[model samples]
Target: MTPPAESCPALVLNADFRPLSYFPLSLWPWQEAVKAVFLDRVNIVAEYDRHVRSPSFEMALPSVISLKEFVPASRRPAFTRFNVFLRDKFTCQYCAVRFPTHELTFDHVIPRAHGGRTTWTNVVTACSACNLRKGSKNLRECGMELKKTTRQPTTIELQLNGRAFPPNFLHESWRDFLYWDSELDPW
Candidate 1:
């Protein structure tokens, strides 16, 4: 497994929240969380430049980045909670009930026995009762309904990285041609 998002580092996004790529913790000068928050995409408009006298090249800053739409600038994704718990908000995605953290389990929206993969789209948070009853059966068979639509990873991975980063920070080295695009913000 990879290192923790905080210590392991984070990825950047475009102003539209499209994922760019991962960056290491030491590569950036700003807070880890802050980098995760602002990095939306790579610098497409501007290219990196280096000086002949200097050994280091310029940092590749974000031309524009997509900020997370649901959470606020103040909050970040919580990776420690695990993806299933994160997707279900720690509540049963089916049944509309809440359970103790331990009592909650991951349920396959599409049963694994039916060829479902262990992807974020196929699994969700569920209470023990709901999961057991729904066990490896199709939803139509059990008359169960999904609370929220399920899909694959969006910013979940990047959000996961940002949880441990510092606040309001981006790498200073990348500022050469990079400028914040507020209009592109709000993904």
Candidate 2:
């Protein structure tokens, strides 16, 4: 069966041929990828079996595309809920158990009532049970110890952490570019 054009998202890579992001698996909808192709902003690293057509033009959809120019990584990552989870590698800082995003929550090491600000250095990812148990109390009071010290993660650190998680779907062509950095076992 022919997959719809919408199902064929193109993996997007920087000029260095690394994905722009990993956890989200840097991708562009077929429409945007085709537009970039027409605008000459990206090079098609691979093409899908699917093709799109107009009255006068038809082109295979891009499965992977690389930008013509490199995009630099940010030095500082944003202090957002998702970023916090990524920084902690989606594990509960107290229990050291991994959970899906929906099951995870952020907890302030020093509860707000105790004058803790919601900043990177004071926040850690926690599962619901951990969050509730630690609610409105300091770690010492709750008898909880964080698996790791809470601190702001560098953008690069977050990026590397993000790579530890791959999106559920990956087109075959993207595999090489996505995991080239992984060390191979010796024969």
Name the lDDT of candidate 2.
0.91
lDDT of 1 by residue, 2-79 (tens): 222333222344445433332122232224433453464223332223211226543433223333543233233333
Q: Alpha-carbon error at 93 in model 1, in Å? A: 0.8
Which window of 10 residues has the lowest lDDT sum in candidate 2? 176-185
Alpha-carbon RMSD to native, per candidate: 11.8, 1.7
TM-score of each: 0.41, 0.95
Model 2 agreement with the true structure over 3-64: per-residue lDDT tens digits: 89989999999999988888767899999999999999999999999998999999999999
Give model 2's TM-score versus the native structure: 0.95
The local lDDT score (0 to 100) that residue 186 gets in candidate 1 is 70
Off-target runs (Cα >4 Å) in candidate 1 are 1-81, 153-187
